[model samples]
Target: MNRLRANDWLFWGSVLACYLLQLMPLPQALLPLKPWWLALVLMYWILEAPDYVSLGRAFVLGLVGDVLAGELLGEQALRLCVACFILMRFRARLRFFPMWQQALAALALLANDRIVLFAIRAVSGEAAVPASYWLAPLTGMIAWPWVFLLLDDARARARVRES
Candidate 1:
């Protein structure tokens, strides 16, 4: 049987911070370029502790974002769920990949999330957002390594404490 790991309070703390950060007001000029902070945190936890947080958690967070952002209901939730599910399903292989490769995979996942959101908006006849909506994935891809390293360090510390 797998050994018991410590509770992931730090992980959840970071996740909460990410969500709060997402809700923070931004300058109108920079709003379009803001990265998907909540999505990034969800991806991090899904990769690090699939047992702790799963697609359902991601979906709920996305739903909260949808309500806060005033987007169509279930829009972000569906995308976040699909993204987390895919990440969890392939996590073992993903863990072995190099940092750059993993970031690339994350970028692809984020792109997929955007596509789903875009498709949903189109179906509902919402006005098309600017091309800048695509930039979030790229920025997220760049920021992922830092997030991974920081969270992984926390995981390592947690593991050591448990032992």
Candidate 2:
């Protein structure tokens, strides 16, 4: 039988925390700048723990995210699934990228994410959003390095404690 690790709490905790962050209130003006916390968290796991997090797992979390955001059902699910699929296909190249380059990859992924959402909204004939809406992914990209480091450190510490 495969051994299960003892640091499960850390993984779940970080994921939950990201979801909670996604739900946090912000000023109306600041809403446009709120990064996709859940996506960033998902990207980390997709890169660092691919064995544990896969496309199906991303889709479920995306479903939860769709509900959390009160969006059209399956919007986030389809978006996240696509992102995860792309990431999984490119994992070999991305996983080895230096932190800076990884952040670039994150920026690209998030931009692609926005494009996917835009297409969906456009298809559904949703109202146009302000130009500021496009900037949120930039903030997410800028924060990627820090988020990566913090979670990676936490994972390392969690594993050490487990050992």
Candidate 3:
């Protein structure tokens, strides 16, 4: 029975910010290193506030992301659904871990996302993914700490403001 949180606006704001970040253009050489912003934000919500961000929401978000990115329909939806499924399965343990360990978990989750991306590209007969394809997860791992801290601080501030 997860009611709408008072800080729900903060959650949606951060998600919109992530989507905007994901859409930002990057230099060709730097493109492979851009962290998966949407995945990181979704993982944070899933880990910290599972009741608010459920599997169905993840699927819907993924579909919207797919359309925005001009990707094959249902591609991101399936990947995000899988990510949510795993996160939800392990939420009991992950939710309580220290931030560093949680970042490690996020790293693993982002890696899973990359694997899914690779499979999708292969199946679609796209150019072989470069070896640098693995860099995004590592970049995402590095960014997780900062993203978590900022979002957590924002959520806390929003709670205090509401109170």
**Candidate 2 to native Cα RMSD, angstroms:** 1.8
In TM-score terms, candidate 3 sits at 0.92
- lDDT tens digits by residue: candidate 1, 1-163: 1224344577668867787878788899877667787777777777766776766777787888888878789888888888888988888888789999989988998888889888888889985788888888898899889888988887787777767
- What is the C-alpha lDDT profile of model 3 across 1-163, one tens digit per residue? 1224656776888878978998999999999899988888888888777766787888899898889999899998899889889988998999889988988998999999889888888889995777998999999989999988888888777667666
TM-score of each: 0.86, 0.93, 0.92
Ranking by TM-score: 2, 3, 1
Residue pairs in clash, model 3: none
**Model 3, residue 60: what's the lDDT?**
92
In candidate 2, position 39 carries an lDDT of 83
RMSD of each: 2.7, 1.8, 2.2
Per-residue lDDT tens digits for candidate 2, residues 1-163, read 1123544666678778988988899999888888888888878888888876788888898999888889998999999898889888998899899988999998899999999999999999996977997998899999999999998888777666656
lDDT, residue 62, model 2: 91
Identify the runs in model 2 with alpha carbons over 4 angstroms from their true place.
Answer: 1-5
* Better model by TM-score: candidate 1 vs candidate 3: 3
